[model samples]
Target chain A: MSKQAGLPVLEQDEAVCCAPMVREPLGEEAAAELSRMFKALSDPIRLRLLSLIASHEGGEACVCDLIGPFDVSQPTISHHLKVLREAGLVGSERRGTWVYYWVLPEALAKLSALLEIPAVSAKAPA
Target chain B: MSKQAGLPVLEQDEAVCCAPMVREPLGEEAAAELSRMFKALSDPIRLRLLSLIASHEGGEACVCDLIGPFDVSQPTISHHLKVLREAGLVGSERRGTWVYYWVLPEALAKLSALLEIPAVSAKAPA
Candidate 1:
């Protein structure tokens, strides 16, 4: 009754086994938290501010130092920083004359990790 | 600096050499573009929609397939998909009777790479 035969290919089946490159997608809670972080980065000013702070010497920047790079007013930068801080993407401390802000590595790492999708395989499923 | 003394510590100097862990920050144009992508992912529904598309078999999803999972109306999901498409995070094509969406790996990689903050060194600069 048995002849040589290959395993059935469920190519079009929706419930087929997941390929190696795919994993469980982001859940609602994680998506909510990540979206908050992404929302903070949704503005160019805030994204630049974050990049500047992260790439600056010592990974921290004085509020006084940040103002000169942009055409925006000090109040505007502060508002952007407030958004970043509230989203947990950065931490700040008031020093003598200015507040210093630094990127929160864990937060950045989490966002980075979520966005890092494994490359989809060129080889079809066996 | 003429003496055999250690290199001057420009720790507080704003123009000091870049640390190994840091790179040139994002430029204005890049910031603008990246922010748009981040803005697309700023909503919870959109983020999950993207994840769903990216992780689905063959790395794409039929819009008809996507509408069933969310509590929102088909129009709402369509709206979110439009945002993702406009931001370049996903691409779409129309086939027989439906639009299929797929994540654009390069776009995701760009966002992921930008957010990857190299571990800020615990050691001070030489």
Candidate 2:
């Protein structure tokens, strides 16, 4: 199947190397890649899950530590974690029966850079 | 009809004041509010549409200027604009027969701030 089948069409290489999102329309390829990442964050449960993991002690959070706060089924929380893991937003490691998650700062930093405005160039004298 | 009918559940007031999305699991109330904003950004077409409108000359763009570059039907573009409008990402003004869109920089700034990392504090190393 074409990669575009389930995704927005884009020129991947062009997307990875382009002006920031504010400066121009994102190329189709770049948009899809970026959109998927955003979509992963489009859900509230997932965003909270990410936050909890990121702020946990030692920069890592255990599933056991996560399940207590939310009333949702444990499986539902796990599903959200899986989505985040696949999006490269979070990393997970299994230790015995528990899984621990930690933020992947670089991935989120890339996403942030897309929206970054360069320090405003020295303003021409008005 | 309840507002939650078509929207994710969230407590609006609490969401507006809270720790960043990365520092804690977004409360269901906060998550819902924040998720809608992110969902508006989850589509590639919408992202490009936002950028195109923001980067246009004088920080405003006309529908006539944007329609030429994409192959999609005008209605499709219009639909995306409506979504962005409702999400408070852009503002539209009618000038004669053409509609112009301008960036709402404060709205986008609010979003960026939600993800911002506070500067690290000065500390003595052990």
Candidate 3:
């Protein structure tokens, strides 16, 4: 696969973490694991929060940097960030007085792959 | 894009429907739309049901074909299918005494694209 400039090399294992949903039925354990991630993404605020942190400079942002854009309170943003972190979609680190958050590419990639509709499934019924 | 054998052509509009989450923060409307779809996927039973229908013969399956594998009652399975249908992730048709369900590739593709992490965001911090 062609790598994008300035991007970290994806882990080989995670590169193929999930089969396309159309290839076969998901096992119960896999469905449960994936559903937890989807549950975290089920809220609008959380979705935007994830997007903001991911698109921020250096592919990371500080908690302070995140709070200014939304109408919600700091605690609310923090609560949503905590949920994203718990879902393994983002990671955070404290630097002196502030916390920095970044997207976990592997997690996002796994979900993306899981939702891929196989080319075969795109066909109209014969 | 190369077309897949026996698959219906994807609409040009849908082929480019969603920008990657890492490209920019999602707008309120877009986030709300996507979160609704994600909410439908939050349940484990629904996730498996989507997968099973997508992978079944002719890229669709009848209600009778679906009920045998799960331990849940038929009404419960029917309820989950309704949720998936209402979310626009799957479509259904009634012929005689049974209903056949199929995954909507456009919907799945839209969501898959939304979760995609841009390559630039994959880089480790310097």
- Each predicted model: what fraction of the native A–B Cα contacts (within 8 Å) does it retain? 0.62, 0.50, 0.80
Pairs that clash in candidate 2: A10-A28, A10-A29, A11-A29, A48-B25, A48-B26, B10-B29, B11-B29
Of candidates 3 and 1, the better by DockQ: 3
Best by TM-score: 3
TM-score of chain A of each: 0.75, 0.77, 0.83
Model 3 lDDT tens row, B22-78: 877777877888898999999999999998888887888998988888889999999
Looking at model 1, residue A48 earns an lDDT score of 84
> Which regions of candidate 3 deviate over 4 angstroms?
A1-17, A120-126, B1-17
As a whole number from 0 to 100, the lDDT of residue B83 in candidate 3 is 92
Ranking by DockQ: 3, 1, 2
RMSD of 1: 13.1
Instruction: List the candidates ranked by TM-score, beginning with the highest.
Output: 3, 1, 2
TM-score of 1: 0.78
User: DockQ, per-model, please?
Assistant: 0.35, 0.29, 0.51
Error of 3 at B122 (Å): 3.6
TM-score of chain A of 3: 0.83
Tens-place lDDT digits, model 2, residues A5-124: 454443434336234566656667777777777788788888888777766766678999888888799999999899999987888899998888987775665566565544441111
Candidate 1 TM-score for chain A: 0.75
Model 1: residues >4 Å from true position, as ranges?
A: A1-22, A120-126, B1-22, B120-126
